[model samples]
Target chain A: MSLSARRIIPGLGLFVLMTVVAVWALWPTGGKVTINDRARDLAAELRCPDCEGLNVADSTTTSARSIRKDLLRRLKAGEDEAEIKNSYANRYGESILLNPDGGGLGILVWGLPVLLLVLGGVGITIAIMSRSRSTRLTPTESDREEVKKARGK
Target chain B: MKYSARWIALSVGAVVVGLGVVLAMQVGNDPRIDATKSQLVGQPAPELSLRALDGTAVDTNTLLGKAVIVNFWNSWCIPCRNELPALKEFANRYRDDPGVALVGIVRDDSTRAIKAYVKAEGIDWVIVTDPDSRAALDFATRGQPETFALDANGLITGAQIGPTTLRDLESLLGSAQGR
Candidate 1:
């Protein structure tokens, strides 16, 4: 390998390693994710049904406060997250869920964007690889003479 | 992209657009929009047991087999006062009906103010106070003058968000009776 490539390859490897370490450090550890954390996150995702432009966690409206308390209580009582969310949906309708689910019609809202991005990446990769592999003709002495004549003209 | 890949993407694009149109149509006709117009409608009437202004205990659950009209109001709300005359008349008319019960629950007002208003207005319809608005939140009430008419089976048959007219109350009661 060339001197530049050797230096670049090691540098790139180190950079990738550091990025992975940083991500691992910053990523939420499951051990630290308590019911309170889940409750807070759930509240953040619940739309304050009686308010404009505020989630249950952010809104101080009576309805918002009530739901927050209800959520925490239910969470503490051993009900799972999805069941609690479904109960809220049944009570307040699905609009109360600010974040759509990953499945069902909600897939259109979430999965479509991710799928499109992946497809776009694949398309770009294929295009670049195809262009690189395309045939290239080498210039003969006569071809070089013709190019020199064109430049002179 | 390869020809096959291009066609796959195009097909995905077409399907997405088709789903988009369907979703848009669904949103346009969504009954939830109207469902939230009065959130308590089509929901089971929440249970409430309270002490009336006259020191009498009133439990809504006991009256489950009868048509019940729950009126949420406050002393400070103008609409509540405006609708009181009709509510009084409605209550009077239903007093001997045996099949209907009208109960008024105070909201967002002090006990003193409500007592004053209830006494001064001669408002005699089983007036009760909802502390901390617990019952109100359960009923999904936005504000004062919200009314819910519930059927014998505990389902809320109809709801009104604003001031109740005699006609509106009558209509709601009729809906509760499956008329």
Candidate 2:
């Protein structure tokens, strides 16, 4: 209802909106997860050992084809996503997954960027808040006396 | 705009993070290679049964109590061709050694092509045809010229990728406790 209140509300709304946009844009991107796409999606995370820089989902090599077939079979057998992934990892080690694991040294690879982004956001918000506070008008002694006189009248 | 310490810190952090990622990608990274050898080693070799070109049944169970060397190859693979001579020689040297067994599983090729290559190379060892490549897949074979060395207990003791040599086979067989 007050003038300052209205301005502050819109500014807060804008800050929140910008944050949501940044997170949505910078967060990890993955395809839609569905039963039909499950096998293919997991396959995309596996690299073809026979081919250079090719994922199993995109490779026609025998190794890739065999892995894809096994993945599909496991999926149909009602295996959990992590179970299927670990199956390959058990055989191949952590490197089998296209995405690094969230634990161990792999945590650094997946976490550093997110941590930096959040830190950057917090830093920017602090800088902006401090700048705004410094520039805003502060009530002087004369201004306070004028306010008191107005209140008395 | 002046570059602040915040920006410099972020830049340094980013470079470090980038370097970490690049280094991580290079470490233990062999996407093309499945964990077959690592996982299968110390575990029993998967069950396999295939008929040779002569229509004789070759079963893994029968080959127990002897060190089994299962070599997966295809006629189309150049490395497979190159490794054939060494394999034949190894088989010949160990022909009288009942403790050693060398078996070749032909993959992804027609019986005719496999038989012709076997006869031309005089492989002489147990050459079996893997009709649908089911056996090779069971062994987690990535491509041609991958050989698996199994101990007398049927446990996989060694896995060699690429074109293998006589020395490779010797080393594998040498470390095999069964031998």
Candidate 3:
């Protein structure tokens, strides 16, 4: 084999191995989805009606326990998750869900942080790149004079 | 500063200030549930088939022509105790009126304690036990002392949280339509 091909082959193999490992690690498990698992997952997203700042899964309040049990029963009865969640949101208010709806005012609540993060990242990158460029500029006559004066002092 | 750095700083500052202003505007954002604005309002009250303390089967499905006042309370709650007099007065006022119905569901309390309290307080209204807190869950109650008034059509007309005064109860009853 050619020297360039020999050098590139191991790096390509390593990259392919990394890509496979990453895909396998990030892929969701294909295990059986049980009613209990669905119920618990939904419960984690629902707010506890009687408690302060606690979701149904974490709260030990009677209302939380009752809701969790009700979720399991609903799931077992072949009701879809959206049907159950909508029923809850209808009975209670929209605040019952830990995460707000994706539409309407929920868009602002979920989108603002990400937008701000991107803007901030762009600003930082620009600042850093410009700083590097500025540092590379050669010293002018005035700059040398100032440096000499400082050195003399 | 370089031109790019200055622009970046200005934009960042502007965004930070904008975010601050937006957040500052929400300083008065109330997280607590609004008492006057229950989601159940204008919706039919959930069907009830619960057992009362005195072995009476209190089924709301049977009370079609009467307005229902479902009050969720517990003996341990101070607000529940505070609102007892208003409720008792309401029960006395509506004793002979078949057009109205009052049902008090116990929340997170024992039957023994409720029975004792009912006996001592002379609570003649339909006092029911919420097994597994089913009624509370059905009603979507936040806590004790939350009351809901349903009109004769089984539509929830008014809902109130916290200790309610006699005047408040009267206003709630007045709001119930379709009677």
Winning model by DockQ: 3
Please name the candidate that would achieve the greatest TM-score relative to the true structure: 1
Query: What are the DockQ scores of the candidates, in order?
Result: 0.36, 0.21, 0.39
- Output the number of the lDDT-best candidate: 3
Error of 1 at B144 (Å): 3.8
Error of 1 at A32 (Å): 2.0
True contacts kept of each: 0.15, 0.27, 0.54
Which scores higher on lDDT, 2 or 3? Answer: 3
Q: Residue by residue across B1-179, what tens digits does model 1's lDDT show?
A: 37947776796788679887868877866634633466557878888878888787887666788899989988888889899889988988999988898988886678899999878988777889877677876786756788999999889999888898999999999999999
- How much does each candidate deviate at the interface, measured as C-alpha RMSD after superposition? 3.1, 4.5, 2.5
Global lDDT for candidate 2? Answer: 0.79
Pull out the clashing pairs in model 2: A49-B32, A91-B35, A92-B35
lDDT of every predicted structure (CA atoms): 0.81, 0.79, 0.84
Q: Summing lDDT over every window of 10 consecutive residues in candidate 1 chain B, give the lowest-scoring window.
A: B31-40
What is candidate 3's TM-score against the reference? 0.77
User: How do the residues B23-110 of candidate 2 rate in per-residue lDDT, one tens digit apiece?
Assistant: 8777885643444454577778888889988999998788899887888888899999898778878898999999888898886788
Q: Model 2 clash tally?
A: 3
Report, for all candidates in order, the number of backbone clashes.
Answer: 0, 3, 0
Error of 1 at A71 (Å): 1.5
